[model samples]
Target chain A: MRTTPAKCSKPNFKIHHRPIISAAIAKEQQIVGENEIQKSGFNFKKYMTEKANSVNKALDEAISIRDPPTIHEAMRYSLLAGGKRVRPILCIAACELVGGNESIAMPAACAVEMIHTMSLIHDDLPCMDNDDFRRGKPTNHKVYGEDVAVLAGDSLLAFAFEYISGFTVGTSPARVLAAIGELAKSIGTEGLVAGQVVDMVSTGVKDIGLDRLEFIHIHKTAALLEASVVLGAILGGGNETQVEKLRKFARCIGLLFQVVDDILDVTKSSEELGKTAGKDLAVDKMTYPKLLGLEKSRQFAEELLAEAKQQLEEFQSLMAVAPLVALAEYIAHRQN
Target chain B: MRTTPAKCSKPNFKIHHRPIISAAIAKEQQIVGENEIQKSGFNFKKYMTEKANSVNKALDEAISIRDPPTIHEAMRYSLLAGGKRVRPILCIAACELVGGNESIAMPAACAVEMIHTMSLIHDDLPCMDNDDFRRGKPTNHKVYGEDVAVLAGDSLLAFAFEYISGFTVGTSPARVLAAIGELAKSIGTEGLVAGQVVDMVSTGVKDIGLDRLEFIHIHKTAALLEASVVLGAILGGGNETQVEKLRKFARCIGLLFQVVDDILDVTKSSEELGKTAGKDLAVDKMTYPKLLGLEKSRQFAEELLAEAKQQLEEFQSLMAVAPLVALAEYIAHRQN
Candidate 1:
């Protein structure tokens, strides 16, 4: 089997191409070494590029301009707007990790991204965050009138579920239903909406603490991320245990992604990311950097990365988890 | 069985309690003439009250205030705000017409109502129609602020599919998935969103003819009502042909409901319906009364009612269709 020892911090650690141990054996071993077999050969940049391309193509084809050219145009404009497609890629990777193929998970991958895009569009509305720009361009409401933008957001969201349930093929009905349920729960009041509401109400409140901040992030960011991963695994025909493991791993990565984002906001200038830097601080929005100092926030990100990586330990093959591991590292180290 | 021949316009029409013909024979006969035996024993008022009460109970239990109580409170407040519960009743009635009990269709019934309520909440936003009141109470955005109102609408829409897929019992997975797809499609861009966008863009524009007006109403109102009835029939195990026929019936009734609503807007005083009367005329919004004369609008409603009733002629038992027939008449004759 091909092995890449150089990817690991310790010379003794090896990246094995073949299954190293059964999950039960791995549990017994309690695989504890941080320097063990990191499998950096996953080539995350290439994987993400490929996955993003597929998701983008699928999303582009998903919506068409029907009647009332205005709303459809608005929906496609925001939905097809460029973003990293992180949630979808994570979903596809999770599905593959659980012995499922991309065809079975692609519809759901598109769904998560659609939901994410709609949330961003609505969040940037004048009555909401009131941000004029998103992804270095004018927000949806800025391009379309507020009325059309609102309807566009609603349309995208409704289409997400429709595409998933109606367009998915070669999958068991049970799995598809399960995935739909998971996707819905992630966005409703107890999840993304809850986080958004709390964030909106907590703005400029001095008494906000670590717990409240965590609550916001878990709902706003992690809930959807976890749903994406869990849905991929479920639709991929993963057993309950496998789905749960991926959920935990995704939760860690979700929180890690946000922490690193907060860190980057303080560390990078506005020109670097094409977005306003230190805006959270300017608005007195409760963030990891605000609740914990920058140093502690960085430490928290590292801890989350470690926890995310640890969840992958039970996988039969490092190769199977290579993409997920690389994704965690990418979140930890992304420059933008 | 109790029969009320007096309700029929023709004395020759008789209300039959038993199945008079086999489905095959009924299809072959292509029964015509309005003076045929019609089931007049159905008490629409009592049936609607019972179904509405049950649906209200189900919807009340469907959503709960969890964390971030503000959004949940807003969602429930708007959702539980009393309307006639038309969508849910249609769903239940269609299911019964297909020989399925209310238990088989209640989840989908609740889901359609949730979707309807969400649409109303979003439509009343300051950016949309900007209506201050709905169902005789302050609008969601008016009470909760626009930010929370948007989130509340989103939460309800998402929770709708989640509740149907997760909480549904004693139904096949295929039917449940199919119903979810139908519900999503009805509310998406080609459906409710399409209607809303057209209405918003065409506002204050003169020369909107009957075709354009029908286009708006077909999408804005008929789509959800059609979905409600079709989904209920599907969940109740209606064959494809049966479901399709019911879909046609629903389409007619849906259009009829709108035309009557337009007629009432012109004829009723504001005090009668507790809503603004002649508001459509005030805004120059195209309506049945505006395009066609009021007399023609009333005649159009009657034609639609006849078409809707004609679709039910193939049913083996008049008892199965009595409520639906009554609903059509109610739509045609309702003062408000």
Candidate 2:
């Protein structure tokens, strides 16, 4: 069996709560498929490091410092700053799982990273989240000034499409167009932007329940993550069934990532995390930990992870699915 | 002979003004080539109205209000707001000149307009130009708060590529890919974004010369216009020679648009012009009228128009090229 709930759950847990993805958890976790896969000895840390390094190299080559240095500097600053490279890695791994190699996925991998970086930069603006730091450095607006930050964000967004459309080699134009459509849908009003506006609107309003919270997280965080995986699969020539399965897998892990983030907010100190901790509690924002008790939240995370892993079991080659299984576990277990 | 040095040329009109496109202008203005073409009597005003109406209809159908209300509302507000529809018209006209129809160019036409609208929204932001009104009403940020306005602009930008890549039908994938590349390049650091940064940087600097002014205009204004025309040519199956000639023609007219804009700055009042007139001079910003002086700027405008029309002389079908010639004259003559 898994570890006892007592040892895993936070001591400060409160029981008065709403059901957070409990239905999804019940539906998705019937089979503990990934437990066996995990025991088969996959070194997730090693896989992540190797993939992250390659993605970094590709991203560096994708964008170089050019004329009008400030915007480029701002772009490179946020882009190169250390993140886990999770989305690009997910993209690459998904591509590989569908019988494509790393080279076929690199342009799209870099493009997703660029889109994520620009979103972060824009989200941190003074008029937006007003955050002064991101990824352990001053935010784009802080370092480059708001004007350049805005332009840099806009430039990065535009260039992501340009890079994907112009730079992708060894792929059919049909697949490329499909990938572009997916990327565009992820960021538009019905996707990332839609989530952002509602999240902003939800602030300071009473009765922001678990459903509302999930809507925001799914749109703001999960949408792009879904796009990342789905685009990779498409670029790799995954068939309809394969693409749909991976999309479901991506959505679960995407939500799992946010639930874990909310849990960490209450459990980790700012010094340990490197960014402001307990920001959710301070703002009284709606988070999983706020809606459900910390214990239930952790349990919810596990259920989602299990569900995510179950989707991967459909792929016949267990070894090919190892990296993705490892990724879900990483999201479930990361400290910051 | 053209107007003499006294009545038209600004006293400050440096006779040695780099002979800007004089050879091309001389070659192009040969009446021996198209003087009879001028007598062919194309009705530009009627052509513009009909084409603009169709393009506006396509653009309307291109984006619609959906799920989350506010962001969609903001997007629709700016996109559907009536402008001159110049870029879309240019795209369609270029396609027609190269022997293609409106249907083949509509997606790209709408895409270019989307890009232009997004740029205008961002440029009007408090962080950017801080303008309070645009397209005859309160700007986007004024209508839907700044946060939503920024997102709206971003959504529009992303959706432009999506609309082109996804909705475009009856076009070859190679042409689609080429169009995407050209559109992306027109908006990135080397294109529209570059122009914006330089224009921002040049605000208060001393001795802003004509070269710097041209650099700003070429990137800011001309790049997208060139993209608009060239993408149309590519989509219409224009040969390399046709594409390159149209590109040059577009570049001339694009600069002509800005030159006329600067002249209007000095000549029109804020009431007469929808936007703030004389704002450029008020800011002590660099402008064509300021450097070339009003009379000489007009002469430059005329030369550029001649140079643009000359490029179309190679088309060999005068009636087919009439709309473009009429567009050049329109840019030179538009009041607002």
Candidate 3:
């Protein structure tokens, strides 16, 4: 059984075929570290824990065991199964940064997480990635039968929209509708499904390039992330410029998340990652590390982190922007 | 290969274990027939054909072949494949019944169809009903592989919401939000999924009662049907009383649909049904025909149809209610 890593650590630089980082990127990393630490006294770990706890509580309340217990049980089993809650945290953080309270964005936050969970469940199906586990637990299909798992995922997807439209408070219907549109777009053919279809079809094919790789990751991973932040900003009453700027920021960090994930897949052990580490390599799937080399991938992640933070520089409130800055760092540096 | 019946016909009452209809129900059916036909000179077939063509055009335009052709192709294969477009036409009919034009309800009409198509794709998966054909053609999974079929279903479900929120015109955002909420609720644990889980679990269980059977069909079939009409009414600026009345009408006809379907299942051949016939009996699944005798089931259906029509009595415009009246008749009497 795979076990999760105990702590976040630097990427394994001693791995074979990985070249040393250039002086420019090393210097850029140092500047980002100093600027972010000196700008705010925010403790990201505590903030994340608090936000995740609140979101979990809300999710628990939102999807209680009603009639037809099995499907609801299956849905809750996967949904409550632990992750870092990155998407919900990003949603809340973005909302707060744009002058909106947590309550206003809570439904949207839960919505993104539900969509994320649904994708994970379906991706782990026997017909898809065929993973035996997710987030250190038996995958949904392993615990429940595939039929129930599929139904559970479908229920979660539908309920996410229900929860958002039915439970969101303190936001105008127009803004709520806009947020819903963003979310729906992120998961459909033009969004996550688009990437998934391309990725599935491209599997086992040789000579895949950076363009195809980027297209997959951008849609599969970044689309929802971008939606998360955009939804928060929109619900929080952010101005058009603020929403657009934050959108760019989210895009950078979203890609950064994938790059870091690719680096960790090859560098870490199965025990360290909770999931099957090196599975991508086993499947001959393309990744940032495979294309750019490990050191360069790390450098790309750092650059994305820097660019993500740069988008927040005009906010003028160091305190307001600190959580987002730290979130970028977290995405860049998470080990598992 | 299953082939569709060429024409609609009355139920087959000559089968073994089926009794003749009672005089009371026969008289009630005659009264309803007279009331509906005398109220308006509406041509049900032309209205259905025109409405279905319009909805098909909108749906075709809504989900064109875009990037990553496989998933789009799969979605269109199931979505645009021939069906009666009952849900979309119901939406348009309900909209018109409440003084809204077809254009005002077009997006929602397409949305309900999208959701319906998604449910069908997912339902036909190997892990679910495992059917090899649908609508006289190969199932989505049969044509596109299970993985792509799943993704296509997901894409359609998400895109349904996206289309509703992004394309709905001449309606307030609040009404659109309300419609979205209704659509979402109809498919989640409290609605369709709720029924599906119960039905899946109850398969082959001995001594299943009419109540459990009703619960299943209500959620599995009626929920979406109810949402279709309710959404149309809501988006078309219907008053609260009108919407509620239509909701009742939708509920009666929704249950009527499944009851008639159950009756037809044992009475029709695979060719006449356009899909697997007697599969429910083969699996010993709980259905209306199995619970209540076939004749009693038909009598119940007539009662439901009458109650459904009764809900539209106060609409004050016989012309406005004609399409809905015809629609309920179409659902009750459809051969496949």
Candidate 4:
């Protein structure tokens, strides 16, 4: 309710918070603009700060005391070692936009972070990416060794569910279960594993097509992102219809974000990226930059961003969705 | 109902069902005892056989896809490659005994199998137990190679939740969520990882003490077994009181099972174990039989079995629980 309404139709404003009558939804044709409220994206920096602190607390509480402190320590070290809290912030922002309280989606936010952290841990393992640096520090397996890293990732992944379903909470059990289900699918074989397999197999192959590229991003990066936003909506009290629209919006953004990331890999520097740069090419891995070419990739991202913004036209205001739109834009241009 | 009046009171027969339990739990428990009135042990073999097929079916259905067949194949191979199916069978049987449908508990059953498979797969990795055989077949890493084996374990772990939350209908979402919570804790740093860590570090440390010995098995073996029975009660309509009692029962059985298993490992040949025997000795790992010596380990298992059976006194009928009671006896005596 504290959100601004100045952007209702301002020329300078790229987004508005009110629902648009100009839409492609077949189901919403009749009642398109009636009783529709606009939603703007929330503050990325502020949202990240608040949610990061909360998620850090939950993660800390979740990882403390594993008898032998090695895995717990490694997990905490990787988790707390700072990176932009983009995924959790998106979850919280999406939750807030739909009129639901942030508390309902907090577990989900923490869970997503845990998933991300776990993936990072495994990616850094010697047998995998073998990266020595993460978040500008030595990677988990680099510091803790392969066994500890594997266990750390395993612990984090499991604890993600614990943080949601096991935590004493305000959310309905059904919602929690649904969130868990969505997360499991997204992070599991059909999503993350399939994507990883494709990525792994793509190495040493000369020509990677758009289909395989889409498959990789959809599973590897976008699936969890889509889950985060949709979960936010579910926790935020959105009906099924609203949730579906937001899911589409998030899907576009997630893909766009990754495409931008891939593009940045070709264009950015390690100092600007905060992590190693151009590793994709180093490993001969296929990326959006490789598949679409830089200019075409940028165009593709813009199209996705436009589609994402259009999806938000269903809402009444730009306040709840502005950050998301901005985030997509930022992603499109991010050096990292 | 087919179970008749027993000749006398069998202490373990308190939960006994006539040829299994009353009307309600049969569909859920899957395997029924010979008769309701009979007084006897809670044997798990029948329960294991009955539920194993269905669980494998559910697992197969859960992994459907055009791509990622390699991951699925490895996961399925490890999942169905035999083993007693003890933990999953316990989950289903517990659910049935509580008067819940097996279909409702099927997800939990499959989840346990997934967790168990993950443990086996990881344990078989070169850095871990390094075995080429599990339950009489080539271990996952042996057949699939270490990289696929690792991903396959991860895939199975993720798919467990997907299979459950995606497939089962009519069950309370809260229960499914709660089951996930239980599993995460048991499998995370607090239970399985913690146990494995201690197990890993304790290797070649021949000067291990009793307290350390308890710690290892408590986590490695008991945590999952405790999770198994607890999940059963959750899905089977068990009240908190019943769940708590069953957890205690499971804890005891878990330790006892390990003791017996360690004993059998020393006693049985490679042909009997379907893997190399004397593995603990070979790896110089700490085990119950290693620390306590054979006779003491046997005595300990028997004591634990008796204690486990004693915890079942509260169940309404002995016949319904015969399979479980018999399982306690069999745990101590089984050769493989």
Number of the top DockQ candidate: 3
Clashing pairs in 3: none
Error of 4 at A308 (Å): 1.1
Model 1 TM-score (B-chain only): 0.88
How many Å off is the CA of B305 in candidate 1? 0.3
Tens-digit lDDT track of model 3 for B115-160: 9999999989999889999988999999989999999999999999
TM for candidate 1 is 0.90
Best-to-worst ranking by TM-score:
3, 2, 1, 4
Worst ten-residue run, lDDT, model 1 chain B? B1-10
* Model 4 CA deviation exceeding 4 Å by range: A1-44, B1-47
Q: Which ranges in model 1 have alpha carbons more than 4 Å from their true place?
A: A1-40, B1-40
Rate residue B235 of model 4 by lDDT. Answer: 75
lDDT of 4 by residue, A111-188 (tens): 888888888887676666678998889898778877778888887888888887876366677777777788888887
TM-score of each model, in listed order: 0.90, 0.92, 0.92, 0.87
Top candidate by lDDT: 3
Worst 10 residues of 2 chain B by lDDT: B1-10
iRMS values for every prediction: 0.6, 0.9, 0.6, 1.3
Q: Which model is ahead, 3 or 4, in terms of DockQ?
A: 3
On the 0 to 100 scale, the lDDT of residue A267 in model 3 is 94
- Between candidates 1 and 3, the lDDT winner: 3
Predictions in order: lDDT: 0.81, 0.83, 0.84, 0.73
True contacts kept of each: 0.90, 0.77, 0.90, 0.73
TM-score, candidate 2, is 0.92
